[model samples]
Target: MDVPEEHSYERVKYIPQNFFETICNDNPDDFETELKKVIFSHVDASEKLGQKSLEELIDYKSQVLLKDITLFQNEGGILNKDIIDLEKKRTATYRKSIEEGLSNKKLELANHQSNKPKDVAKLESNGDYQKSIDEEIKYKRAEKEKLEEELNLATKKKSEQKIKQSNLERISQAIDTFQSQYEKLKTDNEPFLKTIGFKFEDAVQVHIDKNAINTLVETVKIKIETLSDSIKPDNENGLAFKIIKLGEEITNLQSKLDEPTKRYQTYLDDISKWEQREQELIGAEDIELTLKYYEGVLIYLDNELENDLAYKREQRKGVVSQLHEKKRAILEVYKELYKPVTGFLEQYKNINKDYEITFDVSFRLKDFEEKFLNYVNQGVKGTFYGNKEGTVTLKQIILETDFNTLEGVIEFFDKIIICLERDRRPGQGNESREIQSQIKNGFYLDMYNLIFNLDYLVPYYELKLGGKSILQLSPGEKGALLLIFYLILDQDDIPLIIDQPEENLDNQSVYNILVPFIKHAKSNRQIIIVTHNPNIAVVCDAEQIIHVSISKTQDNEMSINSGAIENPSINSSIVQILEGTMPAFEKRELKYTLTKNNMHSIPV
Candidate 1:
């Protein structure tokens, strides 16, 4: 819709159809698909509008898609039996083919059974011949040799036994002669044995002594009975009990010692296990502590450095402003200076007599005046000048002299920032410098702020990247700024909440900036952006949407209905905007519209 250039720009609005038609619209399925396509288009457009980035655009597009998809389904778009039947037919065909293939493979395998390898035959015939011939001959030969050696050794041992028997007979004769002497020797040795308390015939007398010992035993038994009669029963019983108790005490002590030995072994094993566990825990603890400390230090340094950098930025902004003012003053002074020359050139041109000379004078004076003015406007930066009739041209002035002063001023300001950063860095001797990280954190956050509030922020970040102070932002820069304002109004448990965050953003910035921001917000938070950008709504999660439809009732009165559908994900603010504008949007013919006609109006 083209409009008069002189008139303010207005976004087109969407109007819902009447209730009866909406509830009974023909081609409801097609409408849903078309609406889905529209939502995706919006998302695509949002993405290309880079100010908002992909994340934000996706969020907005998701919401729009959800609303349209849901509405389409709620209006009676359903799964068709024809499609289901077709799918089942395809599945059956696939299954039949697979079964046929399996059957053919089984038949082929059965036919190929004879091709299977049989076990390799062993040389049983060779084994039978070897066993019956060579093995039998070798065994008989070995047995005969073994028997021959044994027979020879037995014959030799028999001869040696006979020789030993002959020597024994000679010794027996010598022993007979010594027998008589033995008796006398024994008689002499008997007296000595008695003196030494040993008898030569004690071995023979042992049995005889045993009988005498038995007689003594009987005599001792009689004496024991007499002693028992003399002693008191009470004393004997007490002595016996004391002896038994002592024996039991000794036995209990021995058992107690063994228990300590077992416990000591168990204690040693436990200590060894505990020590191993302790080592493992200690190692883990060290790593965990190191990570925590490093992370903590990084966070602290980031905050501190950012604070300092922000202060430095403020200081630089003050300096940049002063420099700008100085530059402006210089320009103003140059303008005033050149104004006199311009007046002279015009006066001289009017007074010239000769046509050619007059033209030359006019041109020379104009060139000089223009050149001087250009130089003055550029803060007296030196420039080239073309001379003719004692005057220079503006174009010529710009090509000759290099204005080093302005460059020097710019370089000086840049150095000031560099010096500030260098000073903020930790001492060279110290290893804990986080100045660089802090600077990055500060820059990233600042960049985020600009992205969120593109109406003001985009240009701000651009300026910073361009080596300009934040305070020196132009009006255009402010226009491109974007901001993401997050407010946790309540911390209590709740299922979902919708917010109209785009109310603060501009229409042009909305697609590239606000929509993406909304989408980003919704990605992390369950939000519904009431946007006309169908692109954003289409890609959103389908389960979270609640579609609200507006239509005229049978009585010709406007009405609204809400329902669930295939896609349920939507930003609540978008829903609210649509719901609120339902009546008004009914009068309007478009299928979509912004909430308020006012350019900067936000939801209340």
Candidate 2:
């Protein structure tokens, strides 16, 4: 026992995995309500209770227990939001999933197929959600026409851009020819230009006017420096005349160049605009894919396109039907969820016979109706405008009705829900996605709990303590009950350290319940109780007793006196320390003669 090798452990914060708790609460504080923690907590670590299948029990409640409780509760009705929501999502989302490529047509069809109630007496008894397909067709056709018109405009723009580009190229050619002639004229007589005193920097000036060139050629420098300093002016056939001839030719080319130059720039700007608009219609990126995608969507939209979309839609319907059939087949033998509380209760009953506790889970239809309407009211509170007339009708119907059958209840709630809906934002119904991901896990089973469903249920749970409800029990009784359970069922070989267990219980109640239990418990394991009560210390037949005391003279010093009832000094100290305690034992002795025949042994 002293060797470290015999055991292993790791330190942990908060409650450990085994649920071995330090029972510190002096009073019974909602232990009945916290039955899950109580039973499953590995404090007692019972093999029988631990071995009980929580899964099996949960199944039993919703399946087997549901039948009895439903019929017993208020005839038959929906239990909580979870079971109803689960049924709707399963029926609406997964089972009747109708999907097509690149559209919400399938999802709409699926929603219509699954979530909607097919037949209620008030529902005009129309064919099951016929609007899903025909409405889709109408909407698609409208969209298809709009896109087609856009595509036609884009095609026309493409043609216009091509035509404009060609016209621009011709204008550009005229401008280019003028440029070539002008460049040739300059280069053909480069020496003449330099001699004419034109400041042709590294290259000719980018844009030159014939007038400017003419002004340069008439400079005094040009007249003086023409040929070997022969300064002259005013000759029609001389160097000045030759340079003037060059200017005249440039002026003629400039006249030809003027018309196309502005027009060429205008064409460039216009083509850029045209191409931008073209890119918008087709796409800047993914132009090929975009066109192909448009073609596919148009085909789906076109009634006369003569494609396999109908076949595909039909195939989807067939799949939905098959899934529906499978769901129905599964439902015949399976219940959605059964809380394992019933199974838990069965084990709890055996764990402690002294525990006079009983629990009942019931399904109430009236509660469901009230809850659903409350939900409706809350949903309508802030909405600016809605289907008020529809809501009024639904509320009235909900207010006036007691739905008898499960089908009737579901249909009624479905209608109410439809009326309560707002102009939903995108992703409004994504709860179905979340629920779908959780199926068949332990969480899925918890959804079907009759009494509760993870904030979703009003499944009724009735817990009774001592033939009266745990709720009806007084604080004292609750405290006493908590104390007894801790003392009785929690008995084990490890030292049971209790500080004044008698403090909460009345003295008589303590003697009756605790003493017998502690005596029986002590046979199996050690019981360490800190108490000031003399009746407990003497009557429990203690083999040894230790009295702890602080030394009066020395504050830091402490002393302990140890012995049984036979030890003199310990007896003297016990009398002095427990001064008033002797009178109660004296009265008890005087009231009844102390004989072996007078005493009766309590049953363990």
Candidate 3:
């Protein structure tokens, strides 16, 4: 394997090249033949020969012949050959002159060597010269050692100076910190000291000395050490009595402070409780006011009951007109979404007629009265009446009656108020008497009943699907209808994730309705579906497919292998496990071909 020098492979023992190399080694003869064929195919003999020929042609074309031309012509003209002969003779003359100069140089070198100075000979023969040289070298060595000693001494002084400078800087920082702490403590305690009729400066002076801070620190340290030692088995008389007296004083002071702290905490607790009680009373008062307002409305209605009936009839006509307009808008939405619902349903089973959706408005007196009673009961429980046991029952106020007009509804509530006053609870204490008075005045029940009846007067709507009510459908059919409705109603391009959407759907329904819908919807928004069925994955032509395999060994250790569809091992596993071998795929292909032909043979 040819590994790049830039890569550091300490743990990676094998690469893809190693596998290929092993395969090649196992079949060396076949590998060698294939490698040689591949190498030789890239090498063209004709191209190689053409390259050589082109090089030779360029060299031949670059050569130039020397030609002599006459510059001037005269009678008995000087020929070109004569000029060439003269130039050759001149060249020979120059070469001979250079040779003569070389000979002179050789002689000069010999004469100089023979006439050398006597000092040069004497120095070569002198025996004391080597001794002198060794002495000088020894002296220089001593001088170097002296210089090194001086350098070491200078470095030691520099290091000592640096240490002294660092200690001075640290001492300066400690002094600054101490000064800042003193100022902050003084500022924080000044106000408290003033409130207690004590001077802050005098209190600080008793424990601290500003002029001699170091002495103060030393004194405090010595006191702490002495105190610690006296508390031990030895040194029984070392400031033990002073420590005991100070401790007794501290305990007395703490005892004195605890009384006020407890009082303050008690005050806070009582305040919180009172605040909560205040909120409850406020809620009760609001409920009473609401009930009073309802009572007044009922009285007014009772006084003008016959006269308002004619006015209510006109209002009902106008409300009906508005209700019709809202009904048309709802019908438009139903009409728009109904096609998708029917299209989805028809994918499983074809229907000759379209699915029908109709909306109707009508008054349900029984349901209205039940809801009115519930509202009244809720309002009563939300008031102070609920706090008392057996105060009143909602049924007493909500009577069952056939009221066809607005005047009849008001008269019914008026009768309820009169009965409540007549049957007011008899009490002895002031609190019970107050409750009886409130009941006599008509509590929140009157207002609650009036609001409930007014709300019930609004017409209710019923939606029918395929000539049947929505409540009549089974769970699966209802789910299908709702899913289709949401898909049609959703206009934003947000991703929708569904897990096992095909659980309640038949394969035919999944393939025809769900698959086609997802395919079309994917263009506008992202759809992610988790399914175990291959039909959904393959029919949808999913961009990416992941196959996860979990297997346990003999030791019950599970190992998982997950990869994309493009992986060779994953492709093999999918084909074997999901497609059920190659034969199944072949059978499917044959079936599809027959189906396609049958469809083509049918008339348009």
lDDT of each: 0.35, 0.43, 0.43
| Between candidates 1 and 2, the TM-score winner | 2
lDDT of 2 by residue, 28-49 (tens): 2334234434333332233323
User: Candidate 3: minimum summed lDDT over ten consecutive residues — where?
Assistant: 66-75
Top candidate on TM-score is 2
Task: Decide which is better by TM-score, 1 or 3.
Answer: 3
lDDT of 2: 0.43
How does each model score on TM-score?
0.16, 0.32, 0.27
**lDDT tens string, model 3, 54-139?**
22322232222100111111100222223222222224343354445445544544564454432211112124644454344335
Ranking by TM-score: 2, 3, 1
| Candidate 2 Cα errors over 4 Å, as ranges | 1-465, 468-470, 566-604
Name the weakest run of 10 consecutive residues (lDDT summed) in model 1. 355-364
The reply for model 1, stretches above 4 Å from the true place, is: 1-520, 552-558, 567-604
lDDT comparing candidate 1 with the true structure: 0.35
